[model samples]
Structure formats: C-alpha cells, structure tokens
Target: MLKLAVCVSGGGTNLQAIMDAIDNGTITNARIEVVISNNKNAYALERAKKHGIQSVCISPKDYESREAFNQNFLAKLDSYQVDLVVLAGFLVVIPEAMIKSYRNRIINIHPSLIPSFCGTGYYGLKVHEGVLNRGVKVTGATVHFVDEGTDTGPIILQKAVEVKQDDTPEVLQRRVMEQAEWIIMPKAIDLIANGRVTVSDGHVRIHE
Candidate 1:
C-alpha cells in the first residue's frame, strides 16, 4: 500500500476529504499513515485523533532555526515510512531539503486555479478575494505536485467554478472548496497512486 502523510495548518477540511476517500476506497492501494501540523492548536490534529490516525505537532518555534525545524519534520515523516506527502492547508514555506527529498512525491491543494492568484502571499480567502476582485469570469481550485516555487508545481488537476456577478469572497470560497474536496483532490491522488501521472518539461501528463 502507498502510505500517505498529510500535513495541515488549519481546520483540515481537505484532510477530511482525503480520509473520506480512503475510507470509501476511492484511493485504492493507499492509506493515510500520519497527519502532521505545524500549529499546536490546529483542528487537524483533533481530526486525526478522532480517526485513530497518528497525529504529530512539529512547530517551527520548537526548533532553533528553519533548517532544524524542517530536519525534525522530515525525520518524523521518514520514521513513518511515508510514500506520499499531501499538503492539506499547510501554511509553511517548505524547506529546500524537504522539497529535494520528496520531489514529485509531494502534492498540495491550492485554493485558486493557480498561476493566477497564487504565490507567497496568496492563501485561503485571500486567493478568492483576488479572483473576485480581478473580475474574472471563473476561478477555482488546483491540485498539483509540489516544487521549489510557490504554487508553481506541475498541475495534476483543476476544477473551475464560475464567479457570479454578486459573489463575495466567502461565497466564492465556499463554492470552490466544494469542488476541491469532491473533485480535484481525489482525482489528483488517484492519478499519482495509479501511476498515470508523470512530470516532464514542467508539466504533468496523464497517460492512458
């Protein structure tokens, strides 16, 4: 089985989606082995505990430097023998070492249809606000393999949500998240788990 380690920094709705997918057999041949969070009080930890999964808190504040924190974080993940790393609402800028170690094996769910309103400062409702403010006709979610750049990873899946004329940030965000949890995330993981995805020339190709 492909063992997955999920990292989170918030409420963990996306992590819940992954858990539901695993329980429903949508992600066959894989299991979520651990859920790690950088926030000690993040609700994701409680969610993991409820599901009887291993929950760990490796706050950056606990270490002397960013490198040390990342080292400890990677060590914990390595101890679990994690095959895939999923960043579900995780907020930290991943260290270069972790990025090098996981490479294409790490995946993240962005709140926007990326290469659009995404980067170092764009996250959560901020992305939705940017999309709505830009007067774009459509915006949605992206699930992609993690790379060195912020949300610039090879795209694995995207689901678009039409932006209504009167849509507020909260409204658009709720709608986007609905599609995110139900569509993009599951499809991305399935592609990776089934070996249908490959990264080349900065793009992810889904092979038949």
Candidate 2:
C-alpha cells in the first residue's frame, strides 16, 4: 500500500476527500499514514482523529529556525515511512530541504487553473477573486508535483469549471472544490499509487 501523509493549515475539505476516496475504494492501494498541521487548532487534526489516523502538530513557532521546523516536520513523515506527501490546504511554503528529500513525491492541489491565477499571493479565496476580476469564462483546479517555486511544478491533472455570471469568490471556491479539486486530487493519487504516473523532461505522462 502507498502510505500518504497529508499536511494542512485550515479546514481539511481536500484531506477529507482523499479519506473518503480511500474508504470507498476510489483511491486504491493507499492509506493515510498521518496528518500533520502547522496550526495546532487545525480541524484537519480532528478529522484524522475521527478516522483513527495518527496526527501531529508542529508549529513554526516551536522551532528556532525554518530549517529546524522543516526537519521536525519531515521527521514525523519519516517515522510513518510516508511514500507520498499531500499538501491539502497547507498554507506554509515548503522548505527546500523537504522538496529535495521528497522530490516528485510531493503533490499539491491549487484552486485555480495554474499559470493563470497562481504563483505568490495566489491562494484560497484570492485565486477565485483573481478569476472573477479577470472575468475568465472558466476557472478550475490543478494537481501538480510540488517544486521549489509556487505552483510552477509539472502538471499532473486539471479539470475546468464554468465561471458563473454572478459568482462570488466564496461561491466560486465551493464550485471549484466540488467540481474539480475534489475530483482530480483523488484520481491523481490513485494514478500515482498504481504506478501509472511518470515524469520526463519536466512533464508528467500517465499510462492507463
């Protein structure tokens, strides 16, 4: 089985999606080994507890430096022998050490079609807001390998959602999560777990 460790900072809707997919057999041959959060009060921890999964909180404040915090965070993953690291609403920028350690093993789901309403200062509701401001006819989600830069990784899968005429950021966020993020995230994980995902020339090629 593929052991996954999910990191989160707030509500864990995406984390819950993965858990549900695993439970329903949509994401096969995978298990969530642990859920880690930088915020001690994150609801993601509660979700993990409810499902009898191991959970940990390692706040950045507890460590002396960013590197120290990264080390401790990674140590927890190592303890679980995590094969995949899923960033589900994790707000912190991943440190370089973790990126080097995991390489293409880490993945994140961005709220908007990346390279559009993405990069620094583009997260959460901000991404939807950008889409609304730009009046894009369609906005969606992108699942990609986690690289050093913001949302600049090789794309794994993407699904587009229609941008409604009277949509607010909150409404658009919900729609994207329901129609795209939740759907593609589990599909991508399943593909990776089944050994169907391959990266070459900075691109992802999936074999079915």
Candidate 3:
C-alpha cells in the first residue's frame, strides 16, 4: 500500500475527496497514514480525528525559528514512514530539506491549471479572481509532482472547467474545486498508487 501523509492548512475538502475515494474504492493501494497541518485549529485535523487517522499539528509559530519548525515538521513526517506526501491546500512553502527528502514522491493540488494565475500571490480565491479579471473562458485545476520551484513541477493530471460569464471568484473557486480539483486529485493518487505515473524530462507520462 502507498502510505500517505496528507498536509492541509484550512478546510480539507480535497482531503475529504481522497478519503471518500479510498472508501469507495475509487483509489486503491493507498491509505492515509497521517494528516498534518501548520494551523493548530485547522478543520482538516478534525476530519482526520473523526476518521481515526493519526493527526498532527506543527505550526512554525510554536517553534523558535523557521529551521526549528522545519526540523520538527520533517521529524514528524519521518515518524510516519509514509510513501507519499499529498499537499491538499497546504499553504506553507515546503522546506527545501523536505523537498529533497521526498523529491517526486510529493504532490500537490493547485487551485488553477498551473502556469495560469499560479505562482506566488495566486492561491485560494485569488486564482479565481485572476481568472475572472482576465475573463478567461477556461479555468481548471492541476495535480503535479512537487518540485523546488512554486507550482513548477511535472504535471501529473489536469482537468479543465469552463469559466462562466457571471461567475465571481468565490463561485468560480467552488466550481473549479467540484469539477476539477476534487475529481483529479484522487484520480492522480490512484494513478500514482498503481505505478501508472512516470516523470521524464521534467514532464509526466502516464501508462495505461
């Protein structure tokens, strides 16, 4: 089984999708071993507890320095011996050490089809805001292997959602999450768990 460590910062809707998929067999050969959050009060922790999964909070504010936080966070992850790390709306910039340790084993679900309304300053509702401002006809979500650069990883899966003329950022965000993020995130996990995903030349190639 692919042991997963799901990290989240706020509402864990994506995490919930993964859990549901696992329960319903949409995703096989993987199990969430732990859910970690930088925010102590994150509802994601609550979700983990309710599901009887091990949950931990390692906020940077609780530690003396950023390095201290990073060390403790990495230590916590090490304790789980998880095979994959899933960033489900985790807002924290992953520590370089963790990235180096996990490498392509880590993956993330971005709010938008990356390279558009992505990168710094474009997270959560901001991504939808950008999409609305640009009046783009299409917006979507991306699940990608996590790299050192922000959203600059090999794309694993992407599903496009149409942008409506009357959509607001909040509404568009919800639609994207429902149509794209929720659908693709779990699909990506299943693909990876079954060894169908491969990275080459900094791009992803999937096997049927």
lDDT of 3 by residue, 1-208 (tens): 9999999999899999999999999999999999999999999999999999999998999988999999999999999999999999999999999999998999999988788988989888888999999989998999999999999999999999999999989899999999999999999999999999989999999999
The C-alpha lDDT values of all candidates are 0.88, 0.94, 0.94
lDDT of 1 by residue, 45-120 (tens): 9999999999999999998998888889888888998888999999988888889998899999988878899998
Instruction: Give lDDT tens digits, candidate 2, residues 1-208.
Output: 9999999999899999999999999999999999999999999899999999999998989999988888887777778888999999999989888899999999999998888999999999999999999999999999999999999999999999999999999999999999999999999999999999999989999997
In angstroms, the error of model 3 at 162 is 0.7
TM-score of each model, paired residue for residue: 0.96, 0.98, 0.99
**Model 2 error, position 69 (Å):** 1.1
Q: Give the candidate order by descending lDDT.
A: 2, 3, 1
RMSD (Å) per prediction: 1.1, 0.8, 0.6
Candidate 3: 10-residue stretch with minimal lDDT: 111-120
Candidate number with the higher lDDT (1 or 2): 2
